[model samples]
Target: MEDFEILDFLELQQEQQGIDKTARFLQKQIQNGFKISIVIKKQHKFALAPLQQKKNDLFSKQHQPMDVTSQSSEQTENNDKQGSSTSSHSSVKMNKKLIIPPTQNETPEQNNNEQKSEKSDDDQISLYSKKNCSFEHLLKDNLLSQKIQTGLSFMKDGNQKMALEKMMDAYREGNEKLKQCQDQQQISVLIIICIQSLCYASQLLMDFGQFSESQKCLDKCLNQFEINDFDLKCKIYITKAQCNLLNNQYLQCLDNYNKALIQYEQINWRLEVAKLLVKISFVYALLNDFTDAKKICYEGLQILQSKLSHTDPRIYDTYYTLGCIYYLEKDYDFALEYLNQSKEGFIKLYGEQHLSIIRILNLQGVINHLQGNSIDAMELYEQIVCLYGDSQNIGLALVLNNLALVYLDRMKFKSAKLSFDKATAILKVYLNEQHPTFKRVEKNKKLFVAATLSYL
Candidate 1:
């Protein structure tokens, strides 16, 4: 009985040792697997980190507290469904939809700070968008707008050099901002501003006698803007035509003016069309197509007569052009008639002593001189000389030459020589020696001196 009892004790002890060893092995396996699972979870979160952060940022901007409990419940339900879908898999994977949970026990101050931060972020984004978006936005920005205003003020003050510098700087900055623009409406508005700037710049350049530069500016605008608006296109075409006219590219000028007229007609801009017709008449006169010039001038005058008062500037321009055409045709009677009508318009609008009146007076004097009325022509010339007031400009030079011619006609040898010398000096100072006016004055002075010597 003792030996049997001892054997039973040994078997029980061996069985207890085997059970202990099995339990330890199972515990080690569980520890290693838990560590591997933790590493895998960390790698997964790392891969999803940027997307999760973006979602969190969006939530923060909403100004509402995160519903952590509801999100957790939903995530649990999703995991159950996913687990059922993959029931035959060896292990269950956690759902990867990262829902950031709100922290509990947060102070009111912290929440307020978060809301303020979000608002500040929104404000910054909006500001950035405006600065890069539209011409109106730039025009609204006080600093940027001030640049444009300052440029205009400079131009108004007759400081074109400074105005151009400021305007060009603003334009360049605007162009850079335009490159960043994403919206089409913003692009259209910005383009309009750019075209306006170019137009103004071109006119300014023309005023400074920078004809080539003016043409360059217009070309830049034509290349840059694909304008659809009729008014804007008309403005561009007119500017281009003016530049061509100044360059003496008469055919090109006519073509551009006709294009602008077409656009004007589309909008029923009759007044502008009339003005364009007068300009086209002038071109025809320059080309020595007097018949067409007279026809176009009459067309323009008829249009003006219907819509404008007799004193309208368009009427003045048409009448003046008609007078010139008739004068070129050597029809002094018709020339005087049209010229008197033009002078009446000028006198009505600008009074007798005005420059416009002085110009018409010069033309009338030429007509009188041609008609053998030296006394009347001399009187007109003297009036122009008095209006000059010591200014040695081109207008003054032209009038002095005409005055000299009238003196020569009257056989006032001493007075004619004096006037011719003075006129020649003015021309030589302002104009090229090879200019026709200077050559004509020289030839006339020679003829006058020779005739007087021969008479003596």
Candidate 2:
């Protein structure tokens, strides 16, 4: 429910007094998650022509906020004469959505306001093309989309090399076409194409484990676009964040996630914001910032509770995260409680044998083992071991390790070694000896040997 930037609107009157008043109003309205944007598409249709002319005179495109010395004050006043009548001397009001179309009578002016409302905040900056044809025009004018599409098709088919090549073709095309962009629309189309192709290629490169190359693609895309391109910038930050997440660079992931979170917050896109907050909380939990992690995680669930059903998979995920955090904190009681809730939710949503249940069962088993509830922990571990059904995986390895620990605690050395050996073999294949999971199992082996000797 935090207020965030939803739109950057074009105010027809940017007079010093008017801007001061507008800024003050915006400061107040922003508290409710509103921002200033009043686009009279029909009236401003002609109002934007000089922007193009200004471009022709000097710069390649208008500056962000796209300032142009517009039509005289008198003409602009006459255009909004209808609005000026009852809007109380340009007094601003705020609401969750609608900006209150002046005079609700069905004039084309009202329809224009309807169009503005129909637009998401991102569309507000398309000053020249009021028709919202940018996306359509994007499809039509984008020269390299075929290549980009082919790249994705190759990616879908699991052909990473070919996918990378086609994306390169699109990238080169974008590089060439962007330089040739003479107008705002042309450049806008090229920017989207560039970001789309580059972000896709960046993700593709991530799969290849060429992270530096992947990052270079996004860096180039970021450099190509200016700050005013909020949507495009947001996409790049998200892609960069994904790269960081995959590479386990938690701090960088938090930075990028927070950047996108700010943009989502501005629009008061509560669901997305909540989802990001939960993700951030997970990362914080990974960093052992349990205090903030638990706080943010609960806030996320609260937001979701208002929007989604109680049994929603997303809420279930939040529950699982909280469970994990509490487990890490060694608060087994709360950990089990949340894990049980998620386990039930997942079972109802995806059925008992679904892989989602494996996570809950595994964590719950670990919690039980930590609590010295060997019998309960053994049962949960055995259940998931059966559910794994011959799959060799990290989760299965960890569970087997836990099951062995439980067996060791119960003094069943024979059963313990059998479980421990299986875990050892899996970890040898999947993890380096120095890796934490492997190290844990290896360290346990030493203890197992000592206990065996003592038993002998």
Please report the candidate that would top lDDT against the real structure: 2
Instruction: Please provide TM-scores, in order, for all candidate models, with all chains considered together.
Output: 0.54, 0.52
> Which candidate leads in TM-score?
1
Clashes of each: 0, 3
Give the Å error, residue 441, model 1. 8.3
TM-score of 2: 0.52
**Would you list the clashing residue pairs of candidate 1?**
none
Local lDDT at 83 for model 2: 19
Residue 131 local lDDT, model 2: 29
Model 1: per-residue lDDT, tens digit, 199-295? 6677656654466788887877666644333444565677788777655566677778878776555434555656777777766665555665776
